[model samples]
Target: MHSSSSSGSRLSLNSLTFSLPLKALALTVALIPFHTINASKAYQYDAVVNNNKLTVVGVENPSTVFKDGQYLHGFGYDLARNYADSMNVELVFTTVPDDATALKLVDQGKANFAITTTSIQNIESKKLTSFSATCGDLYSLQKNGLNTQLSWVFKHADDPLTQTASGFVCQGKQSGSISQLASFYNRNVVQAESWDSIERDLTKRMPIYKASFQRTAEKYDLDWHFLAAIGYQESYLKPDSISPTGVRGIMMLTNSTAKAMGVSNRTDPAQSIQGGAKYYDLMLSKFEEVPYPDRNWYALVAYNMGPGAVDQIQKRISAQGKDPNNWVNLYSYLDGNKAQNGRYRQAVQYVTRIRSYLEYIKNTPQLVNI
Candidate 1:
């Protein structure tokens, strides 16, 4: 009887051990499929309201609505972020060779959006899976004094609007025309010292000074004009302007930025503008994820007080639970004798002037292209 009891006890212990293993094995089996499903579902849509992971495809140039490095400073960036934020998802940008590639990427489902200053047309509308909305402004650059038609591609074939619009043409040769237009539209225009003299100065300035600015602008994918705007704000386009803190030249470059830009003469007009433009371009590149309208403000602040300070302001605003993109909301937090000082206020004013200038130039009968 004792032997029988011992055998039964041993059998009960074996059952307990086997039962535990069986339970564990069942749990593992259940988890394996769950992991697979999660893995297979790599891309999810509408994950959050204002944080969608969207891939924007655009060109490689600085003027493009979606520049290579400055994805957040143009109309494309603003529209994408606005849409994503409304949906609550993070935006992801994908740079493309051209508009064709952008379209192709979207059609293939490789990108969630294509925002390279696209015009809605019947052909593209049918081909692309997109929503109907004007995301940014379309600009035309024409030779000064030439009347040209501005073209628009409509979504509907029978849309009752002309494909081309007419506007006044500005004589590029007019004194202060470029500057005036720039101030009006908040966009920058290159004013050659003189068409007659540019050929002479071009050779002199090209390699040493202009090339550097061009290279930096290309590197950061920023409009040379945007940099010029910073220069205008900083030093009023005077390469010889000096600040109390010893900031010099058109860009009001300090000794440090000038040196970093490889400028040997901080007072030279060419070197000053070049260095300043490059520096502003760098600042423009930092807010690549912000929308274009808001990006300009951030760029202006960064241009005035350095990007680090602008970042601090953004953090402060965010901490206070306000939208950093909203200039109205950001202005209150940016004011006071705190971190950014009146530099923030000055930056906002400068940017506002630039924007107004851009609009004015666009509307100006003398400057508008027909």
Candidate 2:
């Protein structure tokens, strides 16, 4: 439940009552501060209990603490978050360059502890630091026979925090929580349930409307596969498809959207594809501050939630000190005041399915010449 934020002027939650238009919102840079750990013994317990912050440092490893888009995710981040939660403290993660730096940070008392994906012995062999560990049983020896187990490296061998971490790690392992977290975070999350249908559609239906997607996307300066992915997600490339809400056709355009895009017929496959591409391009134009692929994702979300709501949410995110322009960061805040639980989940699934479909479309060979 720990979230990172950029340094900015803090805004009062009371002032965020009105919805801000997309064009009027300001963007914040995503930055992780390098916090120096307090060296006093009196600060340790007081910092965790009174101050309520647990700062830890680690290197970015895919299976450990890598950054995806604007947010930190992976096993190390989750483990550290859980450890902080056990102590009732907010987790503050700082990224180092390598395992050696991570261990050094802990040994020099710069961080409370460090999470290592490799063996403690490997790091200990090189650094003269007297670091001890509490977690590693979740992993086995590497194929090369080196111990590649994940562990937490703390400064003092007999610190109270170290012992508590040991107990937590042991309990997590016993409960299969550690292994489950590792397995879930390390998997290919991009391959979703919609893949099979997308595959089937690529062969059967995509060839029929590929030219329309390409022509409209090129006209709008967009990726044809991106347009086609939206097409598949909207109507599964069915020209006659209609939603319960009355949006219909290949791209499932609403009557208003169809007319705005100059489409005469919502059921006309080419016109619908043209309208969808044009509308997505319009969404793309609104998120210029967001970087390429993430901007594309924001546009996709805007397509679902509308640009005004996306703008309002982004403003709320900025007021809380997180970067609003990054989709991963943006997505992390979907459980908003407006839609707390299930409705928020559907919005997340929409972006995920479309993103997977976009990747699938990009990889699949084009069957028709544009």
Candidate 3:
């Protein structure tokens, strides 16, 4: 985690930075099949060419791959989903018990690739398996003399799909889509100087409204921690907090928005939290065409910029012949337009800051069950 002073902590879309914990890196001592296969040989598989389905296997890891109800979501899942989208194929995800099982399924041709938590050095030195581009945020585990990186594994060194996957990874990284995805998924949470105050609030203030956040979040099928992040961002969890713009309550809802959400009293904590969750769910439902995780991000952007503004940006994206459903595409265009577009920069920073707070909330578990 990188800490920046509150005065200087506004991260731009292109240069978001965070570090993986060394202890977390030490836990991923996984193995892959060792072989001396020639890398120059051209290889193609019938399943990949004809099936029109991208089968991916991965273990349940919060940062890599995990289940949210019926949906698979994480950094690796989104990465693989992007690759599948590029191929215009259906993504079929299978959750295995561990990295070894995921790799075995790939080797047996049951899965095209495995989202494995290992190092580039490990793959290069001993593993016959081909790997996709690094997912960024590389950390050196000096004790083991290995560089920890998250990558997808394939069965062969020269598979044609491997090259395709690498290309997609490279493009995603270059466009800042991958890092944005990482941020949205809480893969790397950057702790700023405000973190200390947030920690204090989590203990002193959050517990006071935890039940309301949890209650409304469950009602709307949303994460309470996420709702709490919005409250903290908006009004620092003070129900009576009022903005100069007249938006009030912990969620800082406008008068029109409060009325639309059926919020009678914006100063009431329960009503405010409920209204925020329902409004967020409404925003989320508007972007159902977008994939999970990205869908969540688009909804967050919508929450900050209004659904109509987001729609306009999506239209602009489509007009440019880009994938509007992909937030990275949205982010890339916004990044280029930031100098001339205040709304673009606001939406980018809004979602990024919320995700960071959400990550901080998730990491602080003691406040839960209070």
Worst 10-residue lDDT window, candidate 3: 1-10
- Between the candidate structures 1 and 2, which one is better when assessed by lDDT? 2
Across residues 1-370, which tens digit of lDDT does each residue of candidate 2 receive? 2234221111100000111122211111011111443445433433455657787877765445544333554456666766665565677888877887777767676677777765657767644223222244535223212224566777654455655566666666565455444433433444446557657777888778878877887787676766777788888889999989899998888899899999999999988888887888788789888755446667777887778978988998899886787554566577333266665566666765664465456445563332
TM per model? 0.40, 0.51, 0.71
Supply candidate 2's per-residue lDDT for 187. 30
Clashing pairs in 2: none
Candidate 1: tens digits of C-alpha lDDT, residues 94-174 = 556667666665556565445454554632654543332221111322332111221222222211111100000121112
Q: What is the C-alpha lDDT of each candidate?
A: 0.44, 0.61, 0.66
Report how far residue 354 has shifted in candidate 3, in Å: 2.5
| Model 1, CA-based lDDT | 0.44
Model 2 Cα displacement at 129 (Å)? 17
Tell me, by lDDT, which candidate is best: 3
